[model samples]
Target: MHFNFPRTLGQEDAKKRLSAALASGRFPHALLVHGEPGLGQLALLLDLAQILSCEDTATKPCGTCFPCRAFDASALETLHHLIPIVKNDRNSGSDDDEEAGPESGQIDELNESISLWHRHPYGYHVSEKAMVRTSQARELLGRLRFAENEGRVRVVVLPWLESLNDNSATILLKTLEEPPANVYFLIASDHRSGLMQTLLSRCLHLGLSPLSASDFRVAAETLSQRAQKPFAARLLPFAEGSPGLYVELLENDGEELLEEALRFLSATSDWRVFADYAAETSPGAEGMERTTRLLLFLLRMVRAYQLLKATTPANAGTRIDTAEALEQAGWDDSLAAYLGAIDAVADLQAFAAFLESAHRAVREYSKPSIALVGLFLEYEGKANRSVPA
Candidate 1:
């Protein structure tokens, strides 16, 4: 497959390192790419994948090979995609690959399915709903047993590798440890605690940092012609480095939700509304989950703004760059009132225990409602009055 590296944002150092690996011919078979959730990690990976699978052996893909042409035309579908899905025989979907499958049931879903993936040599996105299932893992094992075609390498990219449970991981461990000669695993994740040590040792690590405001603007501004400039720029300051996330917010129709957030913060005079939204007792499960995730994004944005403020002061007032984005997003100004000096970020680890407990509560088995409340409670109680910076 052929791909053109996105001429956008990010640290040139990262690109240099990746390029150096290619030039030196020391590229790892499996790579662990980690960093902030919305910082163009996937886009970088897509470019890297193109480089690896390119038809031209002298350099990057020539984009003229048959496979490259297919990829360029967005007609290639050679990816063996996997992800989480909760299916019951009782439901509309059946497991027969010969029949129209779930991933092929809808236009969007069909494009992400394994059939199209195997035909295409380019980007293949593993959906959040496609959990690493035992059946899927076993299928992966079976597929890898055969030799690849055209002297090409095959890749298995998992964005949220942490989602795999113990059984699935163990099954994958066997494959990861002794992968085929040309098979590669590109696993990206936000939660490292869940991954095992052996698994970590098996892959090369590529740590990603958050994108600066400039790169953020490019990533977002390019989303649509209607919305340009600083508006798409909003996501850069707040996201965890994953454009997938910013895109998810866009795809999920987050504008209304963001509006509600702004309104709720402004109307905080009614503490009940704040409490209702905070506890998530008022909204249903879907609303609660989406809103909670959005709030979490806002909180991260606030942190990013704080970091920006400490480094780059603006105006005579306390007008931090990214902070203004947070305020615009509707974070309660009262929280900022309590926000200690920028020094507080240095001691962020001091509240690790509280955060860990809350995370465990949520990841393990706590009800969504309880988990949401417990998480924020931990945050409210643990943020110290003193700033360590």
Candidate 2:
């Protein structure tokens, strides 16, 4: 099957610059691609790799070329994929368990993960513990120092560069400083704030903004076809322009969660409905997980509501003209009713703060149910107080 990357979804300017870089043979040795999670960083990296390795002398990445076919078949000799691994807590081995390298089992598992990612990059949610350890970095350095096997340009694709540990960072920094003749590094990360300044200074940095609504719609169509599932119109508000996050939600039964979240928010003005939902969802770990997802959806909605609130006219008084605000924000009718239920900016802020706190408390506290129940009760009291008689 031919796996395609959705280039039009976002990052138009970045793509143009990349194309220019390729056209000019004077591209940097290392590139740091930073963007929010689910913004197609890895897919862009793979696209660059394919472009660099394409054998066709004419149009770049003529997918029919030998190197392009090899890439599609997962047999590309010039490209290497690197991922991080953390300490295995389940091994029950001694601390001195020789630095012999990642176990064959771990390597096999990681390779399998990479293969799945190749098939569906956006659908493949990255592992939480995928951190690049020192040994892995050392091994990568050794491989990159060697001459290319194909007698062509070599590429090392590094995603989640922020996960690089101190030792690994040191080794990578050395590599970035020195000259590797024909090798290039393509690094992708979610958060650039955590990356080392020295490392940032060594490479060409390209920052990708979140996707626009129109672009997201186009992307949703492509993702829908790839996933073989019907697209839900409700996902736009929840996705907040992140296609990767949207795919993640889809994998996690996003349609059901969206329905539940919208229902919960709609019931905000009614105590009985809110109470019933709390009773059902504040019972156990599984219930808490669902509650957490609902709260995350709520947070996104509040953020959007806040955007709508900001555009309201000051002379419009305490009671917001919801229609006018929606018009000002260019929000579609889908979100009008749901957002209108939010009485005021103060209420939305308080609601959002509560959701964040509740999410944090559930993750941190031992008894999540108790914490969440108390949280909902408090929010209910505040929400009731906010309503006019």
Of the candidates shown, which would achieve the greatest lDDT relative to the real structure? 2
Please report, as a residue range, the 10-residue window in candidate 2 with the lowest summed lDDT: 1-10
Local distance difference test, each candidate: 0.55, 0.74
Pairs in clash, predicted candidate 2: 84-131
lDDT of 1 by residue, 164-207 (tens): 75666777788878787677677777667667988888889888
**Which segments of model 1 are wrong by more than 4 Å?**
1-4, 7-11, 57-59, 73-79, 89-129, 148-151, 226-236, 240-242, 251-258, 273-281, 312-389
Model 1 TM-score on a 0 to 1 scale: 0.67
Candidate 2, residue 87: how far the Cα is off, in Å: 4.1
lDDT per residue as tens, model 2, 1-389: 12233333566778878877777777778998888888888778888878777767767678898988998898887788777665577544743233557887778867886787678777765566666667788777788776644457888888778777777888899999994767889898887887789988998988888887788877877888788887765566667788888887776777676567667777666657765776677677887788778878778777766656665757244666667777665555565666666543336656887789888986788877667667767887886688675
Largest TM-score belongs to which candidate? Answer: 2
lDDT at position 78, candidate 2: 75
Give the TM-scores of the predictions, in the order they appear: 0.67, 0.84
Indicate the residue-level lDDT of 177 in model 2.
Answer: 94
